[model samples]
Target: MQENERLARTFEEKRPRLHAVAHRMLGSSDEAEDAVQEAWIRLHRSDTDSVENLDGWLTTVVGRVCLDILRARSRREEFFEEHADPSAGPRSQEGADPEQAAMLADSVGLALMVVLDTLDPDERLAFVLHDTFAVPFADIASIIGRSPAATRQLASRARRRVHGASPLPDLRRQHKIVDAFLTAARNGEFERLLTLLAPDAAMRADDTAVRIGAAPLTQGARDVASVFSGGAEAARIALVDGSVGAVWQSKVRPIVVFRFTLEDGRITAIDLVAEPERLRELDVVVLDG
Candidate 1:
C-alpha cells in the first residue's frame, strides 16, 4: 500500500477510541467527529515517521482539537445554550454515530458528564485524559501546553471537583446526606432542606421538566429548598450512573432522575433529568427500601 493509504488505514483503525476521547472532552458527537476528522487531516499533512506511536499521536491531535473547541465554547456558552436541546439531559449514546456509541458503552454516562462540566477547560482536559482515559501526564502536558507536573496538578484539582469533595466525602457521608434530603423533601421541611444545601446551591432541570412545572434553573439555597420542600415524596434512593441518586419511577421505568453534586455535606447542585429519551439510557436501579 502507498504511504497515504497506510496512514489512512492506521487512522481508520484508531477512529473509535479517538471519537470517545473527543466526545468525552467536547460532549457532542458532532464536535467529536469534527475533532477526529481534523486529527486525520493533520496526520496526513504531517511526518508520520516522526510519530513514535501512531495511536498516541492521533489522540494528542484530537485532544488539541477538543481543547480549542472547549476554549471557544467557554466564550460562546450562550451560543451553546441557544443550540442545546433543553429537552435532553446529557446527549445519549442511543442512535448516536455507531463509532461513538461503541466507545460510550465503556462508561460515558450522565453522572460523570455532569461532574466534568463543572471543571475548567484545562482541568477538564487533564482529568479526562489522565484519569478517565489514562493518558500519561507527559502526553497531556503537550496537548494542553503545560509542564507535566502542572498537568498532573490540573487532574488533581479536577479529581477533587468531580468527587464533589475537596475534603473527600465517604460513601457513608454521601448516603447520610441524601437520606436526610429525602426525609426533608418528604415532610416539607423547608428549613431542614436549607440546612442540607449550600448557601449558593443551584438546581437545573431539562426542558421536559421545565414544561412540567419545574424551573429551568433556580439559585440560592433558600430558592432551591423551597422548590423541593414539598416534593420528592415519590423519589427513592437509587443508583444513578453508579452514584447514590434519587429516581422516580412508574413500575420499573424511570421517569425522572435526580443527580446531586455534594460538597462538605451540603448539596451544591441538583441536576434533575426528566427527558424520557435520555432517562431511558441511564443505568438506574432503586436501592433497597
Candidate 2:
C-alpha cells in the first residue's frame, strides 16, 4: 500500500507536464486529457521496480499514445475524403467545440499550430518532443523507431518549415523558376533542369511518398535532376503555404505537393509531401494556366 501511494503521488506531480505534451501534440484539450488518463492507467498496470527514469517512461508513454491517435485520425480523414459524397458538404468536426479549439489555439499560438498541422506525424512528434519540450533525441528515437541522427533530421526539417529558416525569395522569381523546372522535367530536358538547380541540391520525401516509390533522399544536382527528368507531366504550378511551389492533383484533390527552397535563382532543396493529413493542411491555390 505504501508503494502504491508513492506511485500515485508521483504520477499526480507529473500530470501537468504530461498533459501539456499531449495537448501540443493533439491540439485538442479533450483528447489530451484522455491521453493523460490513459498514461495513468498504463503506469498503474506496469511494474516500475526496474524503471530507472519514471519521468522519461511516462513521457514516452504519452508520446506513443498521441502518435497512435494522430495516425488513426489521418487514416479516417483519408477514408472519408476517398469515399464521402461531395453533395454531403464538408465533413463535420464531430466532437470539436469551436470555442475550446479557439482557446487552445490562442494558448498554443495559432500560427504555430497551423504550421504544426502541416507536418507528418513523425516529424510533428520529433519537433514537439525535441524542440518544444527539450526531450533528448535518443529518447524520442526509441519512441519513433528511428536512429537518433534520423530523429534529429526530422526535427530540423520541421523547424525549417515552421520558422522559415531563411528569408523567402521574391514570389514572381520563385514562380518563374518553378515553371521553368516543370517545363524542363516534362520535356526530358535534363540540361535545363540542371541549370536551375544548385550544384549541391537535394530532394527529400516523406514516408508516405517513399512508400509509393519516391527515394527518401536524393542529393546532388545531377541526381536530383535525373529523378525529375521525364516526370511531373501532370504537375501544375501553385502557391503552397504562401510560397510558390507545385502541386499534383487527382480529380481536383491534391495527391502530391512539391515544396521548393530557392537561393540566388537556383533551387537548393525540394520536399515531396504526399501524406494525406499534411496535404489537407497545406494552403494550395492552383494557378490558372
Candidate 3:
C-alpha cells in the first residue's frame, strides 16, 4: 500500500476516537475538530512508517495542539477563556434532545470547567489524560515533558482541586429553582427571590451585555435579587447550553440569555449575555408553559 493511502485509511479508522479525545481536552466541538485536523496534518507531514503506536502518536499530537490552543486563549489556566459560553444551550435546545443536552453538560459541566480553568497547562493535560481518559502517566509524561512520577503527581493535584471545586446540584432541582427565581423576579417578590438564592450568589454580564446597560457584575443574594427580582418579565424558560434557564426574545429572536448554576437547590450564579455572536451560537427553545 502506498504511504499516503495507508495513512489516510488508518486515520479515517481512528478519527472518531481522536475526536473524542480532543473534545474532552478542549471542550468545544469546533475546537475538537480543529485539533483532530491538525493532528492529521502533522501525521501527513511526518514519517508514518517509523511510528509504531499510531494511536498513541496521534493522541500526543492532539494533546499538544490542544495545549497550544488553550494557552493562546487563556494565557494561563483560568477557565480557558470562554469565547462562547460552553453551555450555550444545545444544537437542538428546543427539541426532544433533552438527554443530549444533559450529556453535554455532564461531559463539560460549567462548574467543572470553571475549576479546570485554574489548573496550569501541564496539570490540565495530565488530569484530562490520566484521570479522565485513563492514559497512563508514562504515556502522558512524554507529552508534558515530565517524568511519569511527576505526571502522576500533576494529575493528583488537579484531581484534588476538582474535588474541592463547586459541586453540581441535581439538574431537575436546579431547573425548578431557576423557574422559581425568574417567577419571583417578574412578580417583584423581593424576599421570595432571596429564598431561592445562595447567600453568596452572583450575577455577571459579558461585555456585550454591559454595553447595553447591564451591570458588569452583582454579588450577594440581596444585590442580585435587587437586580433580578421584579425584572425578567419578558424572559421565557429555555435550555441555555443544556441547563434549563431563561432567554428574552423580541420578534421571535433572542435579545439576551440567562444562564444559571445551582447548588443545594439554590441559585449560585447567573450570567447575563447579550452578545449577538454568542446568542446566535446558543441553542434556544422556549419551554412549553
Candidate 4:
C-alpha cells in the first residue's frame, strides 16, 4: 500500500507532460485525457522493477497509446468517406465543448493542429515525441517499429509537411534546387544527389505510382538519392501545385508528377503522384530547361 502511494505521486508528476504530448499528437483534449488514463492503467499492470527510467517509460507508453488512437481514427475516417451518405451534409460539430475547443485552439494554434492532422500516425508520433517533447530517436523508433534513422526521417518528413504547407517565399531559389536535384539524378552524380537531399530525406509514391514500379516509400538521404541516381531522364522541371517540382509527360499530358518539399536548400520529402484523378488536380506547368 505504501509503494502504491509513491507510484501514484510519481505518475501525477508526469501527468501534465504526458497530456501535452497526447494533445499535440491528437489535437483533442478528450482523446488526450483518454490516452493518459490508458497509460496510467498500463503502468499499474506492468512490472517496473527492472525499469531504469520510469519517466521515459511512461512517456513511451503514452506515445504508443496515442499512436494506436490515431491509426484507429484514420481507419474510421476512411470508412466514413467510403460509406457515408453524400447528401447528409457535413457532420455537425455541435458535440464538441466550445470552451475546450477554444482552449485547445489557443494553447496549440489551430493552424498547427490542422497541419498535424495531415501527418501519418507514425510520423505524427515521431515528430511530437522527438521534436515537441525532446524524446530520443531510439525510444521513438522502438514505439514506431522502425530503425532510429527511419524514425528521424519520419519526423523530418512530418516537420517539412507541417512547416512547408505554404506558398514559397522565393520561387527562383526553389526552382534552382529542384533543377539541381534533377541534374544530379540524370548525371548519376550520387555524391551531388546526396548533397541536395536532407540527412533524413524521404520519398513516397501513391498507389498508382507504385503500380508503375515506383517504391511506395524510401527513407534516408543515401537510399533516396540512390533511387533517383541514373534516373529522371524524362522528368522536366515544373511548377507542381504552385511549388517547383518535376513531371514526366507523355506527349503533352503529365503522366507522373513529382512533388518536393524542401527546407534549408535540401530536399526533405518527395512524393510521386501518378493517379489520373490526382494528376488532374495538380496545376503542373512544365518549365523550359
lDDT score for candidate 1 against the true structure: 0.78
> What are the runs in model 2 whose C-alpha is more than 4 Å off?
94-99, 165-289
- Which pairs clash in model 1? none
Overall lDDT per candidate, in order of appearance: 0.78, 0.83, 0.76, 0.81
Q: What TM-score should be assigned to candidate 1?
A: 0.51
- Residues 164-229 of candidate 2 have per-residue lDDT tens digits of 834434666676789899999999999999999999999999998999899999999999999999
RMSD to the true structure for each prediction, in A, is 12.2, 15.8, 10.1, 17.4
Please say which candidate is ahead in TM-score: 1 or 2.
Answer: 2
Collision count for each candidate, in order: 0, 0, 7, 0
lDDT of 1 by residue, 1-289 (tens): 5988877888888999998899889766778889999998888889888778888888889999999998987767656457866554432222234333223323465355556766889999999988878899999999999999999999999988888633322444565688799899889999999999999999999998788788999999999988888888888776566566787766535678899999888999999888878785676645434
State how far residue 200 of model 3 sits from its true place (Å): 22
TM-score of each model, paired residue for residue = 0.51, 0.56, 0.57, 0.57
**Winner by lDDT:** 2
* lDDT, model 1, position 133: 87
lDDT string, candidate 3, 1-289, tens digits: 6878978999999999888887777666667889999999999989867778999899899988988887775653234334535544322223233343343456666455546767877889999988877888898998888899999999999999989766654555555677788889989999999999999999999998899889998999999999977788877777665467888766546778888988777889999878876776776655523
Give the higher-lDDT candidate: 1 or 3: 1
Q: How far out, in Å, is residue 175 in model 3?
A: 6.3
Q: Better model by lDDT, 2 or 4? A: 2
